[model samples]
Target: MRIYKVGGAVRDRLLGKPVTDIDWVVVGTTTEEMLAKGFRPVGADFPVFLHPKSGEEYALARTERKSGRGYGGFTFHASPEVTLEEDLIRRDLTINAMAEDDQQNLTDPYHGQRDLEARVLRHVSPAFAEDPLRVLRVARFAARYAELGFNVAPETLELMRQLSESGELEALTAERSWKEISRALMEDQPQVFLEVLRACGALRVLMPEVDALFGVPQPEAHHPEIDTGVHTLSVLEQAARHEQPLTVRWACLLHDLGKGLTPEEEWPRHIAHEFNGLKLIKAVNERFKAPRDCQELALLVGEYHTHGHRALELKPSTLLELLQSFDVYRRPQRFEEFIAACEMDARGRKGLEQRSYPQADYLRGAATAARSVAVQPLLEKGFKGPELGEAIKRERLKALKVYKEST
Candidate 1:
């Protein structure tokens, strides 16, 4: 059996980037033979094994034909006759279809190297449309390589549009879609992923709320971008630029869903949109099965992000209510992430990318002030049971009042 390094390992190496993991494709190998050689079987749908020493995945060279719908609908053929070229051709992108031999000889049957040099993201074959997941994968690759000036080939994007319209994208399971969406959200240019998806008509299929934001108007004074959709992407981009965590990024993406529901008669004004968007954020969170932390943070940011922006102007009692809503006493990091998401929204305007967000510091100070109130003092004063709870709340409010006055 001949084993060759394949997929992202070879692609990243060719781009002069770091390779985090290595995938091996083995040709001329049988399941029985692989089992006899000490590789542990792992692949449920196909013949894939884990190396006994390195623990890296080594999948047998195989070919698959579409047998049903969605990404999992496929029948695979793996045998001694299955060639490495056949396996490589089934990859989603040309740049990901190259392989390297033990001698470090690169094989480019699909001209992946050429596309790499050209800085284009092209499909390996028409089979690209067979799997709906490729649409997200291509968009993700676009996001990852956007800073490198790489773009999806026009023809490939056309195929993506076709796939988006074919009703196939809807067949993809939400969990699988979330896997791609969350990963793209963490990429260097997360907004590009959404943009490419929108360009190829997939955004409406995948994230209709976000897609609806396009063409929707916003107050030009506050959002120089004017288009709510453009501003949403700008906020997501700001989340990535600040190297914010995934929860914050996810919050940035969904925080403006209510704005999309604004009545056109109202034009640029979306009063009480935060409350209007709470349900939409919950819908998105449930749709993707986002992590509990991510869901909680998204909801908090969606409903109270305006409160974050109005931090300095809020009454002390209101400030304490906001802090209590975040449960900041026990989970301060989530509070910090919430503030970061709000800051991203504030900075996502057309010409305000570098503008200061004093709201963040003000909110942090309020949280600190509330936390500074000692519960031990109330205990010493004979405050007990539910009365102690009231006393602690009163003291915290007093501290926040002092902080507000000082600010």
Candidate 2:
């Protein structure tokens, strides 16, 4: 049997990138032969094994044919006769279809190296359309390598468009879609992933609320980009550029869903879009069953981002109300996350990316000042129950007032 390194390991190495994991394809090998050689069987759907010593994945070279619908509708064929080239061709992208031999000799039956050099994300074969998941995979690759100037090949994009229109995208499970989306959100250019999906029409099927924002106009004075969807992407880009964590980025992504629901006659003025966005954010969170932290932050940003923008102009009582709304003493980090997402939203507009957002510091200082109010002193003053709560609020409000005056 001849074993060759395949898939991401070979592709990453060819691109002069660090290879994180290696997958081996064993050609001219049978399942019985592999079992005899001390490899543990692990693949439920096909012939995959874990090497006894290295513990890396090793699959017998196999080929599959579409037998039904969605990702599960496939029949696999693996045997000693299955060639390495056949296995490679089953990959989703040309850049990922290259393999390398034990002697480090490269195999390029599909010219993956050429596509990689050209910075093109091309599908390996027509079979790429067979699996609906490839649409998300292609978009994800667009996000991952966007900094390196990689773009989706026209033909591949057309295939994605066809899949999107065929309703095949709808057949994907929400969990699978979320896996792609969450990973894409953490990419260096997460907006590109959404943009590519939107371009291919998959956004309507997967994230219709986000898709609805595309033609929706925002107040031009506030959002020079005009289009709510464009502004959303801009905010997501800013979030990434700021190196914000995934929770903050996720909040940035869903913060403006309310704008999409604004009445067209209202045009650019979405007076209550902040509150309007709350239900949409909750819907997205429930659809994907997103992490509780991500859901909470998105909800908080959706409801209070406008308050965050107007933080510096608020009265002390209003400022205290906002700070209390976050329950900052219990989860101060969430307050920081909320500020980061709001900063991204404010900076997301055209020509405002580098502008200062003092509101963040203002709110942060307000939170700190309120936290510094002594609860022990209030209790020692013979306060209890509702009176204790009332006294603490009064003290925190006073502290906020002092902070506001100092500023």
Candidate 3:
């Protein structure tokens, strides 16, 4: 058996990036050969083994044929006869299809190295359309390499559009789709992920709530971008620029979804879009099987992001209520994420990216003041039961009042 370092490790290495993990493709190997050589058999759908020493995955060189619909509807053939070239042709992108031999020699049967040097994300074969999941994967790769000036080949995007129109994207599993989306959100140009998806019409199938925002108008006075969809993408871009955590990025992405639900007569003014957006955010969570933390933060941001922007104008009682709504005392980290999401929204408008968001600092101060209303002091005062809860609330409200007055 011959081992070749393959996939992301080889691709990243060629791009002069620090390889995080190494995957190996074994040629001229059978399952019995791997097991006899001390490799642990681990694959479920195909022949994959774990290295006895390094613990890295070693998948036997295999070929796949589309037998039905969706990504899962594929037949795999892994035999000692399968060539390395046959395996590489099955990959989604040209940049990811190349493999490196143990002697560090490159194998480019599909011209992956050429596409990588050209900064293009091209499909390895026409069979790219066979897997609906490749649409999301291609968009994710665009997001990952966007900072490096890489773009999806126009032909690849056209193929994605065909896949989208074929209604195959709807067959993708929620967990699988979320994996690509969350990873894309963490990339350097997360907005490009949405843009590419939208360009190919996959966004409408996978996330209609977000897709609805594209043509929806927002108050141009506040959002120089004018389009709610554009504004949302801007928010995601801002979150990525800050290198915010996944929770914050998710919140930013869903924050303006309500604007799409506004009455058309209302046009530019989405008076209660925050409250209107809560249902859409919840629907997105339900569709994607989003994590509780992501759904909770998105819900909070959807329902209260406007309150954050109007923080200075809100009554002291309202400020305390907002802080209480987020359970800031117990989950201060989440509250921080909420503020960061709101700040990203405020700065996401066209030509305002560098503008200051004093609301963040103001809310932070309010939270600090509210938390400073020590529960120890109330406990020492013999407060207990329902009355204790009321007492703590009163103290927090009072402290928040003082903070509000100072601000």
Per-prediction TM-score, please?
0.99, 0.96, 0.97
Q: Candidate 1's C-alpha lDDT? A: 0.94
Summarize candidate 3's per-residue lDDT along 1-407 as a digit string, tens digits: 88898989999999999999898999998999899999998858879989899898999999999998887999999999999999999999988898988789999898888998999999999999999999999999999999899998999999999999998988888999899999999999999999999999999999999999988987778888999999999999999999899999999999988888888998988988888899999999999998999999999999998899998899989998999899998999999999999999999999999999888899999999998987888899899999999999999888988888887
**1 or 3: which has the higher lDDT?**
1
Error at 255, model 3, angstroms: 0.6
**Comparing 1 and 2 by lDDT, which wins?**
1
Q: How many residue-pair clashes does candidate 2 contain? A: 0
lDDT of 3 at 336: 92
TM-score winner between candidates 2 and 3? 3
Q: Tens digit of lDDT per residue, candidate 1, span 216-312?
A: 9988888899999999999999999999999999999999999889999988899999999999899888888899999999999999999998888
Worst 10 contiguous positions by lDDT, candidate 1? 43-52
Which parts of model 2 have CA positions greater than 4 angstroms off?
none
Error of 2 at 385 (Å): 3.1
Task: Give the lDDT ranking, best first.
Answer: 1, 2, 3
